[model samples]
Target chain A: MTVTAKIDVKNQDISESIRKLLEDILKTEIIQAILVSQHLPMKKMVMPTLVTDPDHLDGIDPLAPAFPVNAATIAARLTRKPIGEKIAAVLRPCEIRAFIELVKLNQAKRGNIILISVDCPGAFQNKDYLKFAGQNPKEATLRFYKKVMDGNAVEVEGVELATACKACEYPVSENADIQIGLYGMKTDESILVKAQTEAGDHILKQINLSATNEPAARQTAINSLITKRSSFRDEMFLKTTETTNSLEKISSFFASCVNCYNCRVACPVCYCKECVFVTDAFNHDSFQYISWAKKKGIIKMPTDTLFYHLTRLTHMSTACVGCGQCSNACPNDIPIMELFRTIAHVTQKAFDYQAGKSIEQKPPLSIFCKDEFQEVVGIND
Target chain B: MSEFEPTIVAFFCNWCTFTAADLAGTSRLSYPPNIKIIRVMCTGMVDPQYIIKAFLEGADGVLVSGCHPGDCHYINGNYKARRRIKLLKEILPQFGFDSKRLRLTWIGASDGIRLAEIMRTLVSQIKELGPSQSKLSMVI
Candidate 1:
């Protein structure tokens, strides 16, 4: 049975309450470690940390409103092999989805892990997070949480949340074992936590928290957020599709790409031991470049940018979770996510597939039905 | 430009479609000579990259032929190819290339006449569509 519980809040510090919960969880012999974002003494940035000791949980900050990396990659690393013990990981919705994709792809195993996801209030871009965070990130997080939880604009000093976050529709994770909910809850009095899986229920029993039913207001709040984000997502898809619906336009759309491949690195589901783009196949002969230049009069110096993206589109669209990390990592500030999400939306729909929807759903390419897409094979009756 | 003849790239599977093309040649069956056949082990082995590369390299049309359903030498290779080609067709139109430029056909080795007829039909379709824009680019 799904168990709903509360972690009472003190001093109106949501992050501190979360940290205390993690510390309590870590202090037990139940989970060997808890994966979370924590402030290190060396830098102001909150990086993913594996807290084996209860003392280390003091720096835990899942509400920092800064996403430097998709923490699913970290979770995948922790869960890839049999590490002999389980780990509790606090992640965002996208991260859990990406981790699930990794598990499906055989990049990670699901045995020794418990996914703890949050009601993502969304995050700012890396630089913008630093600027908005100012001197004390803890206070900034509290303020950020207060603003977003109240359904106000999450903008700080004219800066706003990252485009991916603003365009995000899936703010609550469905695949997580435990879902921490700050949305539509009286956070100053208490925070809501739902044990979404058997593992989550077991953990709540161990913690000795009283059970409660999911509040009706939580559902209403979540519905409104989804409605707001879906409109944004559809508008983005239409704008991106219109601009990139042709070869010349697609080329021009990616014209600013220097082929640095930051998007590939940032992509969570783009797990290939040897990427086709990095192989000797793309390394053209020096004479071939000169001949191509001679033929076209003047070709783009760093050619194959469009080809690289198209190849990725063909490969990963079925697995893309629309996390917006590609645009987040682009050095040239290209809205790479918009194009990918646009095409992925169409491609997935054509196959009647949703990438990373659940572990039970097989990837579209990996399975097939006898009667799907008959028009492509000219089988019209 | 008035006498434009489309250069078609045909990826024929070694087991079924390749033999069918060979049978057509042996039987002296007449078909368009525009096709440049590249033999592959199976249709499943035909990467979507090859199709994209063919278009990028200025092929007016592409035809991928393999054994009919339940006749694949590799059990379900043709089924996999069907799904991949279907998705490829769906995406090419978004990039301004007509999905008609690519065709996936099923021709058994015994059906040499069907193979010839399919080739004629594909060539005529391209003739109606005119040369692909990839071949008519100002730089190309």
Candidate 2:
């Protein structure tokens, strides 16, 4: 029922094929610009760039195993109020999911943009990526894709993919208007690009790729990848629950956090206009710290580190998409993502809701059903 | 360790729970004098941070009493409060505090006796759990 197509892998390179496809999209008069990850001229780092000229798309590489930031908020800012022409964005599964959550939070709009997503091969943390991509970023991306597609080892040398990626069960982009399929295909040959929405169908028509059928192998690849990730996710949840199961452990677990609030900054769905942490309310008087210390005789220098994280967890776990960027952004590497995700997994399941699953489904707290979570309220028949 | 009287922080919604506490005072209802009440405009106005700060400030337990689900002065404040407290309950235990330390209940403006009864029960429930190890053991 859905329109699917294939883009021939040029010169036996998946990255080249994707680049050429993006170029073709930019060439179209209908699309004004494209937002993609490209290698910076000076640094080896790859970040999201809005490319207007098709010629500049030469360095575009969305397949790289590097996620420096969650671009959902960026997309939100860009699309919050349209700037006349349409823009095509190439995002990962997590990024798309985060953007969807933003849209639900009323931070982003769904109109006047094209969402192109790919089967995520997962990513490495920023530091790990720099070490892995020593000189050639392009080749690093290709090698990473080839290994993942060939069913070879996921890591190179000693560095592996980030834990968030490994724990992620949704590898396929279910929310994108256009899904660029990599899994379940012979990537040395060609990768399938399927249109998942009416907007996707319209854009594919403009590109003029030959229509195809959904392959059986793609579903198999998706299932196996998810199964592997789900087991790891469950293991992570159990381990996190056990370790941080008590106040002492929880205090020590987040003790490294200097109350920097980097996790809040990096969170895609934490879309509050003004956070309570930054407000004057947290500005305790000089006497307050002394008073606390006088009572305890010994106290942590920077108070409320534990309190801050717990507050974030309460405010955010419901909307947490489990992208793991929080941990990635940590200077102390506090593993904030693992704790939040572990708790989020339980909270989301308790409400029978999945964050960013669809725009139609209301957030648990936003709309209340009289019958739902009745057990929580202890309502006897 | 003589009697182990639990220090409880109770958040009372102004329109209902706060009034219930006032009525209890006027009616001379006998409940454990264990709680310190802070009144907010509505239950929805009670941030989870206030509860976390209470436990951190060495309160052995927290009681969040609001208007009945449909009886909120602001229409749906209690509903929102219910959802947040229910979620907070799930997460608090994993952080080393017993989830039972936090209690959420609907007490109407006229239910002064009911409010006292619930307060009595909460104090006893926390008394049995003993003073929380995190808050008590830290205080010198």
Top candidate when judged by DockQ against the true structure = 1
| Alpha-carbon runs more than 4 Å astray in model 1 | A152-154, A379-381, B138-140
Off by over 4 Å in 2: A150-152, A371-381, B137-140
Residues A1-381 of candidate 1 have per-residue lDDT tens digits of: 667888889999888878877776766677999999987777789889988988778877899988999988888988888978889999999898888888989888776898888899789888888888888988888888888875547575677988788777889999888888888888998888888889877876678676677788988999898888888889988888899887778877887899999999999999997898889998899999888777647677687777688878899988888787898799999889888888888899988887777998888888888766778885222
**What are the clashing pairs of model 2?**
A246-B95, A246-B96, A247-B95, A247-B96
- Residue-wise lDDT of candidate 2 within B35-102, one digit each (tens)? 98989999898888898888877889888888887788999887887788888877887777887888
Worst-scoring 10-residue span by lDDT in model 1 chain B: B131-140
| Alpha-carbon RMSD, each predicted model | 1.8, 2.0
Candidate 1 lDDT over residue span B74-113, tens digit each: 9888999999898888788888888888999999999999
Candidate 2 chain A worst ten-residue window by lDDT: A372-381
For each candidate, the DockQ is 0.54, 0.51
lDDT of 2 at A97: 85
